[model samples]
Target: MHDLEGVDRGVNPQKTSVSALALQLEELLVSSDRRGMAQVRQLWTPGYLHTAAELFVRHCQRVVIVSGFPVGETYETDGPAGAIALLQGVKDCGGQARLVGFTPYIDRLRNCVAGLPQLNQRDLLALDRSGDVCEQLQGYMAGFAPTLLIFVAVPGQAADGCYYNPRFEDISDRTLPWEKLLELADCYSIAIADSGNHLGMGRVADPLARLSIVPAVSWTDGLVIADIANWGACGLLALASAFVRKNLLRNLHLTPLLEVLSRSGIVDSVTGMATASEDGLPAFSGEAVVTTLRNAAQTLQSGF
Candidate 1:
């Protein structure tokens, strides 16, 4: 969902007609330049929401979703929200979703799942460094035969062959090289992220590097960029709900999700502190995003 300013300039009208709910959801999720770092980049395209939604419905069945970015010394408050939301979205669409994360953060991931049973996602995975992580994932894929592989807020490898956090600092040892799993031919890949450091941002590495937000290149078949990674996933759910007209995301409650995660040691990625927030947004910001997303779904459901 690269937010390109002029993607609709000469494209097919039907393919480029982004719905109002999708547009409003995009606006609410774009980074507000909070750090004054001016690093919040909008790498989206017209009809991204529709395109991703169509992909979700037409081709995805058993899906593998990966998240869990360690901000400083622990898992942060960004990835899980998006991952959980997407898991619920997938299940609501008659698909099965399996959650994967580093072993260090598996407990936190479990906490998120246990606290939100309404999402009905129970398949959680732990990527231990004891063996080849990619091989294990390939084995899992062989068994599950997923149709889509989605990475949300997962770090991407840089030119230095190491994973870097948002500050351009190295974090390779703590992250799994899960991007390598994309080599599997059985499924298409979609990445949801807010910055260039994410696994999917490799598709636009040059633009991100020019802005100095990304230092290395990585790629994914489909990319969804947003202000907060979770918000992008929520937008996808909204689009899916509209497409199926079944409220696929009705059970997603962002505030309670954040609070559960906060108590479970999920810190704010931006502040690097344990707070019930995403990136560095306050509680109300999370509330506003969830409200806007629900409103968008309501609008679409009402056939407006």
Candidate 2:
């Protein structure tokens, strides 16, 4: 019998909901800017990242960065690079940050299990084996004691032949379930920042069940899902900056940041902009992308 009574009480065995509350508190403390607003609508919809980031930054002192399913071979070329980039951006702006690679053993185990029948016990076992990465990651965190942890899911090419594999989905979400990480980190008082996969990850089957799990995971910081349709890198940077700015201002008033961004018409530019493609995706020019990144960097520095 699944113990859902715990959920009604606003807590999970992993304490996911309580952690989400912490995230909510943080957002309430910060002032919202235009970019922040756009990010809020795009990423969180009814729920918001600014609120979460505010609480996480206010409470945590160290951050651990994790990337999901990086395309291509190991370290130098995978999804982790994006996670590394964000950490570097934070470090460059004078924030404490560290990079942790998910264990390689998990990948090897995956290859060995790929020959099994679809959704067989062997397949499930193989996916379960990937949880070892989480265990190793937890051990590393215990020693480092970071205040915050950021997980980025790297985007891969749509043309890549590796599509429609349910096993990959199971490996990504279940083996290293975010809720489990939140439970482990909560013990250390570390906050979580997650940029879930670019495309909606397994939402159609049970949307509420998926979303419900999110609240159980402690996300005191930002939750960014890159807008794949339009803007791409530009959208991601803009969202990240907005999240950081809102968090930094939790202790202070938000009016000044709002005034500057508003007066400069950055908000209008972002909102009035048309989708870059017929699919309603955003397209950004090279210079525009650079400017957005720079703006995000500045936001991190200014504590907007």
Candidate 3:
């Protein structure tokens, strides 16, 4: 097990070639820096660095929660809120979880759940309309040293009936693409988990592409993905599930998932010990969903 005690704060320059990337991102945060913007254009994709910085700062000290649309639904649900729910679940199990919301959606979620307890709103760096998700993720991982990250995809309508936007193709063209998101998992030593597949949005190419990037041991069928039909939603769940499976529950370097679960009151069901598989993967019908979720949540809490 890797000892997380006394882990250094800030990015390890040797671990990632991100110093140059950081300068470009810093310029974007500074408004009215026309020269900086020009310089950014020559060295990297415009707005890409900014988006990555936003994601990094937002996820700095916490686990990531992502939600989104699936294949069948018209307007599946709010991705940010679903992410929040997962975070809350972690907190409920005595875990420390941070909720990272993508700009406009974050604001909308705040308005939607005005009086909810354990839901404090914080600003994640913006990636709005920049048209580059990969750059955003790269900048985020460079800036924030989060051990776990969850990504959710919301479902919405496209010109051809209902479909998820921001597919892998939409984000992969940039310099640091979806492949980098997975790389961060390996680099930072974070676990990546996802929920089950759904019809609404989980079928998108980006989520699948992300799944392909990570070690298969780190991936899993996430919650919303299993319930919904949209590929976008499924992709988000996959990201979250992967984080939980890899970083939280299964990593021997960190606290054991069983210890967290026992503390969270999820280890023993009415029948007996909760006979769950690693990372909550299938093959064990004896485990209860509530217990499994609680166990996952407890693991997040222990990460902090």
Query: Per-residue lDDT of 8-95 in model 1, one digit per residue for the tens?
Result: 2222212323465455454545635432112433443545556667777775688888998886668888888888888877877788
Q: What local lDDT does model 2 show for residue 192? A: 24
Please identify model 2 stretches exceeding 4 Å from their true place.
1-47, 70-81, 104-135, 154-179, 187-222, 228-287, 296-304
lDDT string, candidate 3, 213-277, tens digits: 21112221221222111111222221233234322222111122233322322222112333222
Error of 2 at 59 (Å): 4.6
Best by TM-score: 1
| 45-148: candidate 2 lDDT, tens digit per residue | 43333443443445335655543442223211122223333444454335656544344523432332333221112211112444475776577658666666
User: On a 0 to 100 scale, what is the lDDT of residue 214 in model 1?
Assistant: 45
Off by over 4 Å in 3: 1-61, 70-75, 78-81, 92-96, 123-126, 153-180, 185-225, 228-304
Better of 1 and 3 by TM-score: 1
- TM-score, cand. 3: 0.36
Q: Quote model 2's TM-score.
A: 0.42
Q: What TM-score against the true fold does each predicted structure earn?
A: 0.86, 0.42, 0.36
Predicted structure with the largest lDDT when compared to the true one: 1
TM-score, cand. 1: 0.86
Using lDDT as the yardstick, the better of models 2 and 3 is: 2
